[model samples]
Target: MVQNLTKRASPHNVNDRKEVLSGSCIEATASEIIQESNENMTVADAVAQMFENLGVKSAYGVSGGAMASLWGALSNSDIDVLNFRHEAGAAFAATEGYFASGNPTVVFTTAGPGITNALTGLFAARGEGAKVILLSACTSAPQRGRWAIQETSTDTLPSSGIFTTGTVFNYASTVESAAQLPQIFRKLAVGMSQPGGYVAHLTIPTAVQNMLMDETQLPEQGVSCSLVTADAQVVGNVAKLLRSGTFAIWLGFGARGAASEIRQLAEKTGAAVMCSPRGKGIFPENHPQFIGVTGLGGHGSVMTYMQEQAPVRTLVLGSRLSEPTSFWNQEMVPSEGFIHVDVDANVPGVAYPHAETIGIVSDVKAFVLQLLDILEAEEISESQLKASQPSSLPKPERSPVEAGSESLIRPEILMEAIQKVIVDGTDAVVMAECGNSFTWSTNLLRFSQANRYRVSTGVGAMGHAVTGVVGAAQARDGIAVAIVGDGAMLMNNEISTAVKYQIPAIWIVLNDARYNMCHQGMKMLGMTGADAIIPETNFEMIARGMGAKGIRVTKESEITAALETAIAANGPIIIDVLIDPDRPAPSKGRNKGLASQGVKSTSEQKPKVQASFPNI
Candidate 1:
């Protein structure tokens, strides 16, 4: 099935080949090309070009001999190739980069442990709804099960989910021949063109990567796919349901693109809006109609609104309403049911299956726009909407800081500085790692714009933000800050990677010398004899050692100055703040959820200070 090309009048006329032989008969077959015609065009190069055509601007991973060809191909292309210290860090960074720039990114690994190490971040990408592709090396057919160096084969790795189209990836395959490029490219192009996130994997054997590919085998640059939208029947049904009774809107990360439409809908119907932790900025948090955030690190104002207003129906836009978002709290459920809209059809009734749900599979933006259209056509008056609105909506409140010069800084004071100096004062993207960092930031900070805040509520990995900030900063070509705890900072960080690339990323380390969340949660659960303490290591010293700027903040008053300095710096910087470990984060809801799940508290010693926020 090999095809050959003859000398043409021009190189561009030879099936659009950028490199073609002049005044020579091209005698190479599809599998093998003459050196004079497609000079040095390997299958790896073709794959890299295909990715570039698909709009991939960056590739991040650790390079090895097995993937030397791909590394060279990607390096030579216009895409920025970043050599990372660890494969997991690269994958995490790729995930954040896709979210920051709205462009799919690539994670390359050699084989075996390199591929395995990237699984965690890849899973996080899937959970957080990011488009990422993993390109890795695998053992050739001749070397299969023969104990090749860094062997990657079916004998060593399970192929069910990793190498096949299953839960882990929307599409997965092994590139055994160059001829498969057309189908692979089509699938990827279609997947990337569709709504929502799409994660894929393509494993190419080291030997096969060097094979020559015909120009006809290369995939086209792009594909066109229609947006997923609700049909008129579904839209009409949903509008009727919302019009029948009082309904509120629940926003999630998936609804980020429809911010303006969501605002219009909320204002038109006078419905209260609540969002998940990851969906913080999708709707303006400062708006009067915004009740509060829901789930872990959420506000009591949301619960207060639910109890007082007691909407008959809830319009859930793109939220999964999972444990972290709702804790599956029966109190939050409306009397009538939920009119849930999402791109994935399965997400509708899964979280709260017992409750009645009318699911509509459509892109959040398209669905919201259609709903607004229906409302507009109905000519719903502003006066009628005002009659249904609540007298006064509950607002989230936080306890006032004492403003003392304590030896250790308060988390509230640190968050206040972040709110003023970074969140509001600048356009830097802010991300909070899991544990106490997420709780403190989500519970305190307020966002007025979409895509300014990021948190991994799906996997909730510890080192995600620590390593991901680098990718975000590089992709956006601006300042990206990570609010991380000491344990996460010590576990995994890309200070060296950021320094290497000179990306202007910032890390604010809450140096409490302990896994404070674990320590505090264990105490709250009445667990005894648990060790969550870590040695106090100066993160500023670590950052400085890695050839990046560093600053240490020991007092609350020093936080603002340190942040201002870090933001002003042109390169990576770490602000190590000695935070008070005794102050409890707002995690009572999570503790209560754990208790209900049969986790019994065994000790009598309770947390000394319980951080409480009033429901305004």
Candidate 2:
């Protein structure tokens, strides 16, 4: 029904009639309904205001005519719009913005290919639970199915990719009319306010973008999102298991704010600590109780501890226990029992079915604090030992870099050089891309604070770190060091956006001339690495082409100086470092499962980690 937006046009309330009568009385359909006050403003202006109302101050996307109205309106407002070379890069950058600032950002794109091009990052955002607003321009209703240029039926709001029901987002819809915007904005407020990341796609038709609307019609911003502590039964159950036997505490990104309470609980219960890769530094990894990182280039200390100590109970806090982090191994899952705490109720018991599990749904911080109180009332002693990762699980020895100027730099030595150049929480933030970059960074570098380290283990997208660094550099008020592989840097528009914005992002490209992860994984499967190989390209030239500083490091002696130079640059820089491809990551044997299923291939070459100078 077309409801009256304001009380009947009165004798003296001139603004009321001027607000609702600019067009016909406010109209809404069954699918899209809105009822609120009125004002005199264009639909574009109202949408722009919706952004500010939801605490989002920045957005990233490409430009096209279909979204020109939104572009113009945003240009007139305080919102910062960052234009990028590709929609995927823009979307990834916005995802980083949310990660860095805790405020969801926007990704604006035109219809059809523009929208489809953004799906990769959107999928990444959903996978990682990063809050992002995907605002796209759609075809007008009249243009639907008429084969209009760049037109598709977005009206139905199909359920695929990020639009499905089972993921992080619970709502997805397009603006059917200008009147529907108030309710749409209400949903936006709710999504942004809630816990866990949310990705909402609001597609506006070109015709509707030009329609008139009212900013005052938007509902009042809702209450802050709140999650209860674990219910008494679940909390008591977890406490009982924790007190009864040898238990280890597992942490993740969700356990970020409760570091002190978590540490206290671990000490009281005599538990060791292990974390997901993204959860590094949330609990001091250097602490003794922190046995090692769980998956990827994770420490062998985990295997040693599990096989040796064999904790009778494991308390998992705010982690999915994903394949990349835990290798999805039977060994990683506890043999005795499990206690899993997560904000989402469904995630607690999902990863380990073989173990007796207690699932607790609550805020990580709240749960830890209350659990500490309970443990205190029951009198528990400090853990018998505090074990550091390096002491318990030292890094494997590297092949000696001969005393020659021509030898390629070892990956661990490169990481140490980068580590020396960092200030932990101040000077730079490390964003590691997927594949070998992830393994090396997670296994080699150590962080001292939360958010200082970031990896897309959930999304595991190759090119994410390079482009996402642009937004991180901008939002974090510090330099962003993107540890990326040769294969990933070439896949996105990292150099273009970084140069355009003059961001202080350093790309440490491990120029191995191959998708080394695939190369190594295939070898483990008894296949050759030939198809994974690519001719080594001079990435220094690529950076210089984009008006950014560039450097190439081939030897150990050059790494320290190169990192120092790149980190000191006034704008974006790329340090293309030659790493020995065959210096297989220390966690090489973690993939034995793949080795078990190896097929009989014609040619199989053993990985090369032995040190020798190769004449280039």
Candidate 3:
């Protein structure tokens, strides 16, 4: 039987659940609001207002004595604050919330160790081009230089260089002048809204937060500036290139707003489309001109086409073409000329040093619209546009399957199953774990306008998916799914958080019972030993211990049934599928490097082989 929670107990209570307030509630009347007008609100109140203005319905963070005031503010607001198991999980969930809804979200942490643990998500956000604000409470101002518990030098925070190229700023140290907060927050918002990315670290000292503010001194609401525009000459040059050369468009996370326009431009110009991992859902992968993802862990055909015969001009929009996309090698793009359109001018040519690149600082959608206008002014013939379409290249043969062997379920199959279930119409979000799971999901998932997918591409942090789902689900008010691996799931105990909040999330744990990727590396090093093997534990039992429903499956036929049952469950559910431990997913470019090492070992052991084959 389900117990109906009261509104007071669970302020976030939905589904007629009982409300249980962990603390006393403070009511605010019109007179109290007017009285507090001049003063800087408490850290908790300020945080609550910030999230409310950002359109965040819910937020996730770890709570402690340091952040109690902020927690009070969050609880007072309509936003539900989920207490996570780790600070990293809280930060990752905040990033995922932004990815899912395009709305700014908050991640709260206490000073010192909590802030340190949360930095990984900040780096991930910077790398993946996500806009996220991390709210952290610091030790009281009086505790400075006294070696107070959980104290650290506040000055050292900015020097971390996480937002080196992008915008990085700190909140005001004192709130005695409440008039400064709005402007400071506006600047932070503008920085985040800028094309590249931004990380605003707001630290509130305990002493300043406890002070009462005089009414009428409060700051005004914040405002953001428009995107910078490109020069006319640059637009003309881009138009000329688009008209003359066969081009392909490479998009990144920052290009989300111009997805439809990008697709239209591709269709109009007869160009092929590719995207970074963060840009997975920006382009419809099923479209004829879509060439799949490019970079490390990308499809082989897409890389071959980009390198060999596809196009002479590459238009990189909203993408920095960072390391893994360039295969950590500078010579990835052999094009004569490259055009990079980003909100930030500094992002281009940073990763690719020697390229002849043109940088345009403008909003991606507005710039593309202007370029389309320029193309129309040129009056290029329809025949000329038709001529830009290259003849279809022959599709490569599928990798050969070993005969008389068990039919192994590939990652593509898993993507297909989810795609079939959700279809293209639903507003669904997929949170994928790091490693090969990321590669497979990014490569195979067919992204639609309504569907969003998130991964920790920047920090490449493991165990991000499970916690990310909690935040994403809260933001969307829809069911969330996490596609994770057994290794990653163990690293972060996310089950506790899920049960505590009663968040109904579906976790698909691909259990292979080993550190498979590392094991593959060990095998390539002529070490056929299985020391890295992890014992198969009952993941379902683990979930049950945390007060959630759990399902275990060993055969392929059981996947669908388990998934259906898990999704229908009223609370959080974990489905642990026992995949084949021996069969690892094949990578395109990685095999050659391993094979070369294997060849050297074979040569060194040539004598043993001959001795064993003496009868032959």
Best by TM-score: 1
- TM-score-better candidate, 1 vs 3: 1
Per-residue lDDT value at 230 in model 2: 76
| lDDT for each residue of candidate 1 in 1-616, tens digit (9 for 90 to 100) | 0011122222112333334432354554533433333555678888887898899988889999888988877876667788889898999999999999999999999989999999999999999989999999998999999999988998888999999999889999999998898899999999999888899999999999999766655645689898888899889888887777788899998899999999988888889999999899888999999998998898878877776788888999988998779877777789988889899988999999899999999999998899888878888886676566685798886777775776888898999899999999999899999989999999999999999999998899889999999899989989999999999999989999888878999999999999988888776566569899999999889999999999999988788889999988988999999999999887544444334344433344333333222110
Clashes of each: 1, 5, 19
Model 1 pairs whose backbones collide: 526-602
Using Cα atoms with residue i matched to residue i, what is each candidate's TM-score against the true structure? 0.91, 0.86, 0.84
Higher-scoring candidate on lDDT, 1 or 2:
1
Off by over 4 Å in 1: 1-39, 588-616
Candidate 3 RMSD to the correct structure: 6.8
RMSD of 2: 8.3
Write down the worst ten-residue block by lDDT for model 3: 607-616
Where is the poorest 10-residue window by lDDT in model 2? 607-616
Please rank every candidate by lDDT, starting with the best.
Answer: 1, 2, 3
